[model samples]
Target: MNLTQLNMLSDAQLAARVAQDIPDGSYVNLGIGKPTHVSAYVPEGREVIYHSENGILGVGPTPPPGQEDLELIDASKRYITLAPGAAFFEHTDSFAMMRGGHIDIAVLGAYQVAENGDLANWATLDETYPPAVGGAMDLVVGVPTIFVMMKHVNRDGTPKLLERCTYPLTGLGVVSRVYTDLAVLDVVPQGFRLVELTPGNGFEAVQAATGAKILT
Candidate 1:
């Protein structure tokens, strides 16, 4: 393989990969930050509907820079457009859809994920940063299938995937899969299972970068 293929996937490429995994005719909620990019790259002909907590369903892709509509924004306040058959409702009603288990999948950002699929995204242990979990608590509990999108390691060159989360957890045993810059992992009964590694990468490298033990 070309050396370039070994490079970590960019945010857009990661989003595309996540989009490819989503099945057709599903209702998905893209969490704040990186997860938001997934909707723009849904496969052609798939009828996946995007949902926003601020009261909109059937969300479309992000609009061009100059075409942004101030009133239509996502949970992160990022500008977004609506699909052809979109529907808008009260914010409470939106939570109803989620709490009622009407949502099929939810792609979220995480600060750290435990080997057993525990999620810690809202805040780190440091009291310097105030916690702003928002709808993440609700989303994890309500959404049946939770997919976490994050980097393999923290910015300080430490692993974010841990044996047990040090930060406050959003949900216990909630995550099903994790899409990181280095690999795609499944949260199995044993621990994190290596689904696939990035091109030109190896199991040893990923194991070294990860804090928790990967169950082959």
Candidate 2:
């Protein structure tokens, strides 16, 4: 089936969906790219402390236009605001927070994710651009829960949720859940377990889009 025919969630909508699942009173890190959008949609009444690997805690939503602080940015180098009681520290301290298990969750983007929860977001086969793993390795090992936010397929219409990742693994069996444009899935011992389908998307359609079998 053609992807355009499916009523897939927009990036903002997908972010909001992921935001709704995050528990209150958690310290979370949003990976660069699509995952960064999740920060702006945290549900009201919940207190989620956002952490930037580049060294900022209590990260807030994106600042309104004309209110941008050129000096303030997240790991993605995108302009951001600070929530109340925000703090800044050196990179050493920032990494320590990530590596010391102080972070509760890490929402990251991915190139591919295997059925067994293997993540391959850091590097791909394309040699044009240098591979940058960033803090993903640290977060996957230290943070208790890992939520991946990414498109369900590549530009060529190949699935990103696969039986086995074709790219280099960032961390073995690290992903807890995956939120894609079509559906939400949990990494279970059996494989990709369908948690929920995006509105207007059917089970079979989503399964066809996925490279691996999605357990009901």
Candidate 3:
């Protein structure tokens, strides 16, 4: 699929695509944006544990409409149900888990990613909206694997996966994989490797639309 075609996928479908890549028994942190949708699509009975920076672990699916507890929400502040062994603690303990390398995987959203795996997703140069880095830095540096979930192209048709990032850097050489609407790419020493593409996408079509080179 091309960039335009990718935009047509429903949010639930996009979330489901991301769900397929998460491994069983992995401890994962879902970033604030689109990455938070990942929990709803994790395959049933997989035993994957979801963590929230707000100090909750083993988070389950979204709660029923009228059952949301104001005090119990995920990092996205969305109402969520707790898993059987879920626990909650102080925020300081939460940061410790993230900064101390306890997380196995982190799924994040990105504004730009360089060929060599530099990431810049928090802010743009525009001052209209204030940018917040939040727990992203902690996740990138402490987690063993970082997966970025985002669109392939910017609003003006600029490629987000690039030869070099034009936005402010978030983490250097830390990204492990990229799950875009068009394809899934693994970040390797040689650069982004094309592991899989959507139903209608071709390798050449994806290459022409991206700034980074894909391993054939």
Candidate 4:
């Protein structure tokens, strides 16, 4: 679908779309924000393991109202139910899992991603907007694969997937793929490659929204 049309998809629908790409036995970490929706999309019968930086593994989903444990929360501080064999530990152990390369894939949200795989999600130059780096640095370097989920363009029609990032970067060259409303792009040795386009979007339209050369 086109960028605008992509919004018509329910959160459940978006979750399903992301789940299709997950391998059967991936050990994944979903970042706060939109990436968390991936947990709801994981296909039934698959053995994917979900990890949260707040020290939970094999997380299930948001708990039903009145069923939440005030002490149990995901990285986003949202109350979540635990899956079978789910474990909780200290934050140190959590970072160890991330920094020690135990994670196979990390899906995160981004504000900007350059054609060369540079990420700029933590901060901007806006004086009124405070900055926060959070755990992005650890996730980027710790995970083998980093997939960014965000809109293709800024509010002012500026491209977020760009030839170069105008915002301050979070990681130098860490992003592996970008999943936007219009398309999916893979960062490669030769630059960004247009891997998949949304159903009703054309390559040129995506190219126009991205200020970078896209390999077909």
Candidate 5:
């Protein structure tokens, strides 16, 4: 089945889905780009302490218009507000929080995710896109649970969830779950396991769009 025929979740909807699974009191680090949106959709009654690689320990949602704080930005350079009790420290210290296993969950955007939980979000083989490893290597190693948020397929309709990554890996066997526009899946010892599908999407259709086998 062609992916274009399926009713996929929008980026905001996908982020909300990811947010629902984050347990209360989780110390999470949101990766750049799409994963950053998860911070805004955290479920009510849940308290998630967001950590930024740029040195903020209590990252908040995007500020309202006319309330932008130019000096306060995430590693992605996007303007962000500070949650209550937010703390700032040196860049090295921020990395320490990530590398020292202080973070419980890390939601990351990915280029390719192998069936065995290999992540390749940093660098692609495409020459036009420059490689940037950033703090991903550290997060995947230190964070206990890694949630990958990304599109199920590339712009050319090629699957990003693959049998093996074609791009440079950020970490091996680290991803715990993946939330994509098409479906949610878990990376188990055998391979990708189906968790749930987007509304109106079928398991066969999603599996057809995936580059690797998705076990039921």
Candidate 6:
């Protein structure tokens, strides 16, 4: 199969796909970057509780333009509003929730995820870019399920889903599934398990794009 860009999901579309997987009444932590957008697209019938590292829990979607409160922000520092019945707490208590296994799922962006579920999202090999890992180390360990939302390829068109990660790891064998622009894949023992593909793409094209073996 040759490369084709047809039907590739935009970032918002990918965010919606991640949102649809979350179950009702689950306490979730959406990490900085693309994962933060998941807050806005949670399924209509489900009630998902959002947790943030900077002392916020039960957070809500980001406000529309001009409705933003610069003072109120999540871990990503994105201006947001609180959901009904949302609570505010101390930073230590917030981390306690993440570290104490209270978070059900954590959706995070990744630089790389290995076949065995090893995750490397914190820093690249370049020392020039200082990394801020924040609560990622804790979330991946405590949360029962980890879902990564990221691009299928780097800017230079290399696979981010790989046989092994070259970057510093945030957690080991922690990723359960990954949602990317090209496809949705689960990190199984053998390798990536195909879930669904973008329209107009075939298994061969996806296999070519990935760095690891693909298992149906």
Native-vs-model 5 lDDT? 0.91
Task: Work out how many backbone clashes candidate 5 has.
Answer: 0
Error of 6 at 60 (Å): 1.8
Regions more than 4 Å wrong, model 4: 1-12
The CA-based lDDT of model 2 is what? Answer: 0.91
- lDDT tens digits by residue: candidate 5, 91-180: 889888888889999999999999999999988789897777889999999898999999999988889999999999999999999999
Task: Work out the TM-score per prediction.
Answer: 0.93, 0.94, 0.93, 0.92, 0.95, 0.93
Pick out the ten consecutive residues of candidate 4 with the lowest summed lDDT: 1-10
lDDT of 2 by residue, 1-216 (tens): 478766689999999999998899999998988888786788779999999998999898888999999999989998989999999999989989998999999999999999999999889898998988888898898888999999998877889999999899999999999999999999999999999999998888899899999999
Tens digits of per-residue lDDT for model 3, 1-216: 245544335557778998987899989999997988887788887888889999899888887889998888888888888998999999889988988999899999999988799999888988898988888888888898999988877777779999889888899999999888777898899999988886677777788779989986
TM-score for candidate 3, please give it.
0.93
TM-score computed on alpha carbons, candidate 1: 0.93
Clashes of each: 0, 0, 2, 3, 0, 0
Candidate 5's C-alpha runs over 4 A off are: none
Report the C-alpha lDDT of model 6 over 36-132, residue by residue, as the tens digit: 8887788678899899898887798778999998879989888889988799999889888988889999999999999999999988999998777
Clashes of 2: 0
| Alpha-carbon RMSD, candidate 6 | 1.8
- Worst lDDT window (10 residues) for model 1? 1-10
lDDT of each: 0.89, 0.91, 0.86, 0.83, 0.91, 0.88
Q: What is candidate 2's CA lDDT for residue 207?
A: 91
